[model samples]
Target: MLRLGCDVRVTDTDNTDKTPDFLAGHGDQNCHIEATTIDPADNPSAEDRNLEDAVAKIKTLDSSDFQLRLIVEGRISRTLSKNELEDKFGKLLVGNDPDEVRRGIREMGDESAPYAEIRGRNWCLRGELQPISDAQKVEGGSRELLIGPMGSYSGDASREVREGVLKKAKKYDRLDAPLIVAVNVLDIRFDRETENSALFGKEQVRYSPNHPEIPAQLVRKPDGVFIQGGHKPRYTRLAGVIFFDGFVPHNPRGSVCLYVNPFGYNTALPQPLYELPHAKGVDGRLNRVEGVDVGFLLDAKSPFKNSGQP
Candidate 1:
């Protein structure tokens, strides 16, 4: 809240505690601040569960470090079992000498097997593999090894976030004060335009060759989530949403994006918190977005006012 210019103080509450997440400000000016996360597993389908399992298995490898950049095919095999694939991969790491490493692993598997190669003057190692056909996706492979961040939001993934926000928001429905739900859009292919449609109402997703940089905004198409007289967000009780995009959630070094709902339907919307100065033009905190935008904090107030301080 200090990031928003609020003279806020937070307190801890245990699992069985009925108290809200925070007691901001001091003395009589204090207000309740409840927080929750939008977990991907809360509402999962059979496929979602399966995919989650796959990701979990990949994560267990303990040696892979990748994100939006993924390795779906390199050093992979559609025909080898997981163990067999791992064995082949291990061969390529046999020694420090690149020439010896390649020669040593050459006889480890079939000549057609994908292998790892150490390239670049500084030895930028890479897994090399080819694509698999549709038949392979379901039947040809014994097991496949994919290393990367969850890419692209499937239809289910998109709907999940919408449902997730509302579901979490409902927890604070009848609360005395405004509520905020912070979500980590992990492994979610989220588009701002599509999300606005999910929240406000239906909006067409348009594509133009000339404007490829921007997704179709909330254009308010003729037949959308919002009709002639009303908006679509049924759970207007939610006052705002805070988000952390990309791989890790709540990484100590990451930043957050805030969105405030001004609609009256959220009758109890916590204006006090939302109104707290953002450190930016609005509720936006001027910090490094995607945790890597250049020129961040150039002319913006530091969003970490309370960092390293009590």
Candidate 2:
């Protein structure tokens, strides 16, 4: 907020624990902002749990020239224990020729990649070996198998985002100023659809009332954090919600976006917030305005060059 020319101050609830995180004043536009995060750990799926366990077990194996892109499918194979996995995958890596695996992957991609599998009646764990590039390998050094961070499955991304917003909404009863909840949604599958569903409710198709000729028109269900069922404006104390994914210190370039509440009890949000990339309802239609890049707001540079590699 300091970067946005807002006079920012930490909120004190007069020794009480309940309070918004902070308050920002920008040219007579004062609003209370609460910041929160939606972490992946809080909502783990069965696939994620199994994949995490499989990776944890296999990443401990020794590998000199290869990294494993592990794939876990079906049920958590009761047939293979963690120690059994380490031993079997370890031997598989040690027995395979890294040169042959590399050549095959280069020739046929995943189809040619040498694969190792251990399967039970209902479950399977598989690993495909790829040669470790020189940049990743240390000189004359052997290391634990390098396991790439991938293959994570999404677990109700919209539900997680909704729960995060609901938790913040219920944090304080009624603040004097406009309340803006800033949610840093950290999930693999979080996107515009997830955000729209979580905050504005799910989309549905209905016939236009005024124009009966229109067969279908997209409309959102009122089952949202801001607009609940019964078609009433809920959480009116909330002026807006600011959300983004994959935000970190010194890097706000996820380009913070805002959703203004049409039925907010407080006055409109400050002009500075409008300068952000935002979505707002106008004439019952949601419109997104492209705004300044967050990098310009904070004068922060990307850690990577134009090539997108550090």
Q: List the residue pairs that clash in candidate 1.
A: 74-129, 75-128, 153-189, 201-225, 201-226, 202-224, 202-225
Model 1, stretches more than 4 Å misplaced? 9-14, 17-19, 26-31, 39-45, 50-156, 188-191, 194-198, 205-233, 246-255, 265-310
Expressed as tens digits, the lDDT of each residue in 37-152 for candidate 1 is 55555655654554445445433332211111233312121222345334544443332343333344465633443455332232122343323334545674343344343233
Poorest stretch of ten by lDDT in candidate 2: 147-156
In model 1, what is the error at residue 47, expressed in angstroms?
3.2
lDDT of 1: 0.44
177 Cα displacement, candidate 1 (Å)? 2.5
Off by over 4 Å in 2: 13-16, 41-46, 57-67, 71-110, 116-126, 130-146, 152-156, 203-222, 230-232, 300-310
lDDT values of the candidates? 0.44, 0.76
Q: For model 1, what is the error of residue 129's alpha carbon versus the real structure, in angstroms, after optimal superposition? A: 6.1
Pairs clashing within candidate 2: none
Backbone clashes for every candidate come to: 7, 0
